[model samples]
Target: MSSIQSPKKGTHSVGVARQYSGTAGRIENCQVGVFAAYASRWGQALIDRQLYLPKSWAGDPARRDSAQVPDEVAFATKPAMACEMIARLLDEGTPCAFVLADAVYGSDHSFRRMLEARGQAYVLAVRSNHTLRFLEDWSLVQTDPGTMIADLPAETWTPLSAGEGAKGPRLYHWARLPLKYQAGQGFSLWFLARRSLRDPGAIAYYFAYAPSDATLEDLAAAAGLRWAIEECFLRAKDDLGLDHCEARSWHGWHRHMSLVMAAAAFLARIGADQRRAAYGKQNETSPKRPAA
Candidate 1:
């Protein structure tokens, strides 16, 4: 997770610093921030989802040189770019249970297509205005959309429960729709009734993809897994001070942020080791007194 911030007061003036300007003295006024995160999730014992900080957020207008920074590379905002990132990681043999993301990444159709193409499964949160179709037999209909293609029949949908106990109520309604957007291609469309957990009655639409055999229960579980990303963001911001660094230069900002991520990783490792030691001690002490 990454965030960009500009000066609150006024725009920065562009000029060349006297010390560095030997041949041509020109400094471009711009906004700047750090894109700090680990590239892989191995140390955390979680899925192989890396924390990518895209360059566009740092006030790079053209987003051309974003990927040039090897430590903190730029990512394409397009859905296909997201797909490419995942594909590269998977190709490198990163193991993961499922892909999870928020609505911003989830809404990208191309990204979804790429995930499916790789035989990868995901549970993503979508916005309230997404489109969907229901599963149904379309062979007998006069308009056959072709193989893997079917149309959802109009029907009244039902509200479904989201999340388990103590996490607060994140409820939604869903319908498993059949869709055929292109010729000779079709897939199951999961339509979800969108409503904020804070406001129960408010309704909207969200979409998802799954195999024909995917059950309602499976979809619900997949959607819930998206919360893991939320947990990641919270830890990054609150625990690691993700948005509080005060570096002015591009390189300086990233270097500082990388330190923070390294610290967090170190702490996580220490905590795990401590837990194992405590458990080992407990096992050693618990049953010995009875025999004596």
Candidate 2:
């Protein structure tokens, strides 16, 4: 989810309020939109979006009517909007490998439960001080992530590259610890931690639910995929004028966002096709060795 900051704080535009804007890295007069993106090895593009209606606007009938908010549209949390989008994706049989999200969604119990109830695998970031539970010597032990990681031995940390970035491989020391509670018979929960090699104190926490056989590397990779959504937001805003909406009505904002997402999907398809063509050409030009 991301927010588009508005130039003026006037009470005209729909969903515009003084709120947290990730783009600005601070609270500003903006409209927040919860978006769902489909990402894979081939390409990534936004598939769904929901404009957040704050309680103030939802309770005000005058504002609702002025902004043309539908009668069925009610106030919903960002995580709830995300869950609805994901449910639609799954119902439509959209191919998905793993769900990835940041602390905003990860810290919500209902949001996490919704994903687990559907038997979906996910790796979600959480706060360093987030509470955690695990089994030790046939006993359930409760602790926060920071305390748990601090108690681990140095040998437990495994250095690995999460994925390639603009600079090079995004290297970090990662570790995973099994949780006591299971999502289901075959599913497992884990507490995953990552720390930067340059600054060990720069650490992040994640909670993952996946198959029991899932490796630390798999969880790390899933965690890294969260960047895909951010990249989508970046490309859409910079290239497609995603945040340039001047609409005051709710329907107007939705219409603009929908059109922008369509354009982004089209661009992503073209990029993927070009990449495949280049790969095929390289293979065709290379000499093949004779089989023995």
Candidate 3:
């Protein structure tokens, strides 16, 4: 999910309010949209989205009518919007390996339960102070991330790269602890943590649910995939003017986003094709050594 900063001066524009925008790195008057991006080794692109309607906007009949918001539309939290979009894609038979999201969506219990109910694996970020229930010694143990990390053996932390960034591989010390909780008969739960190599105090936490055989590497890689959505937001806004919508109506905002998503999807397809072609060319032109 991301927020689009509006240049409009008033609150008349649909979904525009003083909210925290990760794009601006601060609270600003903007429209927030929960987006779903399809990501894989092949490529990534924005596939679906929902314009968030604040309670104020939803309750204000004057504003709703003025903005032409449909009567059926009501205020839904960002996490709810995210679930709706994700569920829609899954219901449409989209292939998914694992879901990845930031703390906002991850912190929501209903959101987590929805994913678990579908038997989908996910690595969702949580706050450092987020608590979890772990079964230890036949007793339920309640602990937060900080306490759990402090109790882990130093040797348990493994250095790994989440994914490639602008500088290079994003490396960190990662560790995981099995929560001993099962979502279903064969499911497993875990608490995963990543500590900055340079600043140990800087850490991130995640709750992972997957098959029991899922490895530390699998959870770490899935956690890193969250960046793909961020990249989608950047490309959409910078190249496709996703935030340039001047629409003051609900339908208008959605229409603009739909257009931007389509353009982004087209570009992703072109890039994927180019990459495959380049790889084929490289393979064909390579000098073949005689079989020894």
Candidate 4:
């Protein structure tokens, strides 16, 4: 579970300023927080993070001095940072199924391309205005929403649940539009849409690259995993002091974040063990059905 935000600041705190969309529209301040979290049926937890440093702060020695930014702190675009993390984690034998993120990473063409090249699949969120390409005579041509999945017939939409939520299974009407490109030996591209059952006019979109045999249920499951990242962020901050960093230097900030993630991971492991134990007990006490 991973997400990014500009942390709140007080007079004495050292924070990196970044733009955020809030009630005020867009605001900037001195804090950038990016994190990675682990999620599963038993529990979810934030496990890692990369603090964002703005270009302004990175290039200015004077600004760095005031903030006590470490000499090693360097500029890294959000997409690049995300790519690095994903690749490194996968390389380290992390059980990555499909990459999932909000529009920030989804809109990054290079990031999507990178994933394709690596033979990794992803179901990434995107804005309404993103373009798509159409396959024609074995060639791809730049096109509009037809390629972007806008003009689908009413019957194309299917009701599906991305995953379970706080109340129950999260349901939405889903439709998939095939893309011009085949990702690779094991990949395929498509534009996935989710419409509200009550308000069909309201729609959300995602761009997905998955295996040729991947079903809509598989893509929906990956899309639903994005929700876990948000939940991980909230629980970590509330229970594990995730945003309580007081560090003014790069090392200090990372150290604080790492410690918080460690705590969260520890708790998640304990929670998983407890759930497994309870599940075992339930099985033991339940009456067995007669053999057929």
Write down the lDDT of every candidate, Cα atoms only: 0.47, 0.86, 0.85, 0.76
Clash count, one per candidate = 8, 0, 0, 7
lDDT of 1 by residue, 76-139 (tens): 4535445665677789877655565555567777777777776665656565444444344854
Q: Estimate each model's TM-score.
A: 0.55, 0.92, 0.92, 0.88
Error of 3 at 239 (Å): 1.0
* Candidate 2 local Cα displacement, residue 273, angstroms: 0.9
Clashes of 3: 0
Question: Which digits, one per residue and each the tens of the lDDT, describe model 3 over residues 61-165?
Answer: 999999999999998888888888888888999999898888998889999999999998889889888877767788988888888898889899999889888
Candidate 4 or 3, higher lDDT: 3
Looking at candidate 4, what is the lDDT of residue 133?
Answer: 59
Candidate 1 deviant stretches above 4 angstroms: 1-75, 78-81, 130-161, 165-174, 181-189, 194-200, 266-292
**Which residue pairs in model 4 clash with each other?**
1-37, 1-38, 15-30, 16-30, 16-31, 17-29, 17-30
Give the per-residue lDDT digits (tens) of candidate 4, residues 117-200. Answer: 989888988877776656788897775543455567778888899888779988999888777675699778988888888887
The CA lDDT at 243 in model 3 is 80
Is candidate 1 or 2 superior in lDDT? 2
For model 3, state the Cα shift of residue 185 in Å.
Answer: 2.7
lDDT of 4: 0.76
